[model samples]
Target: MFTLAIVGRPNVGKSTLFNRLVGKRLALVDDQPGVTRDLREGAARLGDLKFTVIDTAGLEEATDDSLQGRMRRLTERAVDMADAALFVIDARMGVTPSDQIFADILRRKGHPVLLAANKAEGRAGEAGMFEAYGLGLGDVIGLSAEHGEGMADLAAALRPLIEAKPEDPEEEAEADVEIDEDDLGEEADWAPTVRRPLKIAVVGRPNAGKSTLINQIIGDDRLLTGPEAGITRDSIALNFEWGGVPTRLFDTAGMRKRAKITEKLEKLSVSDGLRAVKFAEVIVILLDTDIPFEQQDLRIADLAEREGRAVVVAVNKWDLEENRQEKLAMLKEQFERLLPQLRGAPLVTVSAKTGRGMDRLQEAILRAHATWNRRIPTAALNRWLMGMLEQHPPPAPQGKRIKMRYITQVKTRPPGFVVMCSHPDLVPESYSRYLVNGLRVDFDMPGTPIRLHLRGQSDANPYKNKKRAEPSRLRKHLSGRKPD
Candidate 1:
């Protein structure tokens, strides 16, 4: 996917536009200056077009040895990396001195920059939209990301950049066959198709020792390690083997909390980290053992679960800790509180600097991967499910009981189960949590998202011999009955 970096001065609605384009609240939005310090990237879909959108640090005048200088350097890097830049400007404020400064930077880099005069939806922005032209950066597209008035224009502006590459031969061949007609039907008979090793992305907050961890994993300084925060500006993927498993290891920038992060490249770095999370089968979230479980740590883990990616939590800088057992217990408690969805996810303590527990981390990952890939036979799953219902019944809704009659393991790349019942929609989220816990306990699946889809029955079991079973059940009952 082509990289589109959103660059602009502070308070220019760049994050708003980013959220609009990505169709998610991935970035924090506020009417405040420098709210976004780090770069945030997302795989954006403008209708049918998919491209990577980078939300950059707000461009500002630099004061050397200051935070603003750091932000400028980061913004400069984003411009250099970007194939195109969405040069956002506040239409209500008109063209400011900062806009010219950023425009000059964009021009010097020679990247295609789309001048977006955001907040131009209403009458208030007309003059400012007009003034935006004074920056001399081509046509300014009047857009209101908050109002969502000119998204079509934004899409049109982004089309050429997104649609530049032709489809691959393999993709064309696959496309030739209608996807619906080519349905191989439940990949139930499919074996683990191993062409290459799974890509593993190790990501966390800054100074979480992401680079140190990767260096330890590969036994070399494949990535530069430093005490300074935000040292890594790019998400670097290194190829390696773990326990003889071929793998592509991606070491990503430490994700700062939204408030603290203040660089365009850091935003891009975080976005790239997310892409890796989406693309990879498993994601390892590293934490500093000293501060083992931050809110951001849990959020990263939550992202993996939400994306259906297997998660492994690694607590780095473990060697420095004095009371290892107490800290470990506290961290696990926090993990339980924050990320219940990924219950029993392997939490390994490691020192990326010393290489201690690196093997254990690899083992934990392998375990999580296996758990993620596990499949339960329908017969076994249904039998276990029946026992579960008998032990802990689902709550009734409106005096009508909900029957969870049958369950099937429809898929395994994350192990999805479909439950047939009397009322699928009536299933409470709390009870759904119960079923998930039951699935984890009964089937030995942990450290991965176990999806239980509810469908109303009279939703007959898709995998069962419904036509033959009902008549047989009746006949067996009749045969066992006493003379009346």
Candidate 2:
């Protein structure tokens, strides 16, 4: 897909337009300036044209060593990577010196640049829209991203540049694969030739160093981090490679207790974090070494378990702690006591600041993911079930023995199973827990959610023993008459 990069100075609504084009609220939007510090990309469509659109941090004039300078460099990289760039200016404010500077930079790049005068809802922005023409990037197209006005004009401007670009050979090959499914055998299960990137979300309470850990893992200061709590508002996802495996890591806003979140913006940030958790295949619940296993940390871990995501616990800021071995032991004990749902889950210690124990953390994440995706054969499952029944028979309810006939795995990815029984309703919750624990231990599936469902075997017992009696013979017998 042709890539379009949206760029502008701070608070020009670049992210809002990006979200509008992509038709997803993947990027966090706020009235606050510089809410977006990282470059985020998504698939975008306009009429018949489709492309990958990137939302970049607002450009600012700062020294190369400053944080704003780093942001500028990242935005410049996006501009270079894009087939065309949307140079957005706040029409209500007119083109400022920063906009002119970025415009000159874009002009030197010699790529197609579409000058966009954003937030031009009505007559209020007419004079500024006229002023935008002075920037000399190109003809300015007035549009309101929030209200989605003037998209047709933007599309008309982009159509030519996008269509002029050549199609990628790799994309053509992917198209072939999609259409050539018939050539491949019609096996119900068709594994991909390429490995998809593992989606992992790093989450915890405010100031747990979630972003710091992700920055350490990816080996980049791609995210904006500071000592202040709640520095991160958006759930930023960045691509990464660990141990030769492709990965997508989501750095989310630190979740606070609901009662404490009085501001509307904080609520949105928390909601965004929850969305990341839902989309993640694996979750790393980071804990501050100073405050390991706090109430909020336990709540976040429990949420991940309820979501059925493979979980790994990470203790951050390990470098500050004294008596490493003793602290680790105490952390483990607290982990087992407080969050039994995640009992036996991997708990690795690391200093995201100093880069300690990252190797072990990566290994643990891979192991948890593998365990979550594990599938057991039906024969083995039934054999294990039989052994469990023999070891401790299900309790007799009301002096009637509850018979469990068979067990079969219905699915994997947090493995689920169904048990055929005489009365599924009679199966007690304690017995279900027993079976789930047994499966976890026997299958070596630690820290992953296990689902066990009891189902009654289908049967109409009255017709099983004999043929159906005729109604005519029954009527004659009731009248005391002999039937021929």
- Per-prediction TM-score to the true structure, in the order listed: 0.57, 0.85
lDDT at position 282, candidate 1: 78
Please write out the lDDT profile of model 2 over residues 1-484, one tens digit for every residue. Answer: 7889999988999999988987766787888788877777776788887777889989888856566776788788889989989999998998788888889999999998999999999898998899999988768899999999999999999998888888877776665453212111111111223676687999999888988888889898777676668867777767667778877788899998898999878888899889889868999999999988888888899899988899999999999998999998899899999999887899999999999999999999999999999989989988998999999999989886788888999887788899998768888999999999998888999999888889987545767889777669879899898987
Q: Provide the lDDT at 390 for model 2.
A: 97
Give the clash count for each candidate: 13, 0
After superposition, which runs of candidate 1 have C-alpha atoms over 4 Å from their true positions? 1-194, 459-484
Q: In candidate 1, what are the lDDT values of residues 199-294, reduced to their tens digit?
A: 688888888888778888888654555667876655555555666787667777778788876766556667766776787787899888777677
Residue 9 in candidate 1 has what lDDT? Answer: 88
